[model samples]
Target: MSVLLPPYAEALGVVAERDDNGRLVLAMDFAAHVRGRPGFLHGGAIAGLLELAAIATVQDRLGSDDRPRFKPITVTTDFMRGGRDKRTYAAAVISRLGSRLANVESFAWQESEDTPIAAARLNFLLARATGSPNR
Candidate 1:
């Protein structure tokens, strides 16, 4: 399956591709635009990447036919380590996709998924159709 990123994600240089194991991966290369502190990435950039990854995962799961508007209710991010000067990759797991809410966990890593530089947990409020159950 393929994913389409939002314009902000595109402007941030986020790309979606498959890893060697065929697992979907979202990545962004190191560039001056994302650089900070001389050789590290800005925390906000990494956070933005994490957010986009979560959104992408949710979008892919919902598919085009079931496009329900969703808004973030909460976003919590943990900076495990500073992002170095290299490409960063992110992937998200949806913990719950309920009738009116969704919970997603996203991680950003550089070399391996085992060692994540950052992680985010986000809760979203989903807006369903008029006749759909909100419960």
Candidate 2:
């Protein structure tokens, strides 16, 4: 089945892929749709990228138990540096997981490990999957 996307993610052109170990890696390119300035990515777009990556990471870890639904109850994003107009990579790790709630943290970088782009914390409501996928 195809992966699902959140509303803001769809607007900013977020893409999700499963790695060899079945982990989800969400990525976004700095395009006109998400450019804050001439070449920098918008802050909101960067947040969306981080948030979606975190959510998808939680979903992947939870397995197919409940159809994989995630709603952000709270999202705190720390904008460290400006996201350059390049292919951005997002990686997320689950901080805590519960039956009804999950907390995830993620980071986005331009290329090198030292060049941090953005960091975020997200709270997700784990329930039955809902809504339609973004097409």
Q: Count the backbone clashes (under 3 Å) in each candidate.
A: 0, 0
lDDT of the structure predicted as candidate 2 = 0.80
Cα lDDT listed for each candidate: 0.88, 0.80
Tens-place lDDT digits, model 2, residues 1-135: 456676777787788876687667787877898898778888888888888888777767766655546767889999888888799878799989987778899998888647778899898877654544421
- C-alpha RMSD of each candidate structure in angstroms: 2.2, 5.0
Error of 2 at 31 (Å): 0.6
TM-score quality measure for candidate 1: 0.90
Give the per-residue lDDT digits (tens) of candidate 1, residues 1-114: 568777988888999987787666799999988887889998889999999988888878887777677688899999998899899999999999887788999999998889
Candidate 2 positional error at 44, Å:
0.2
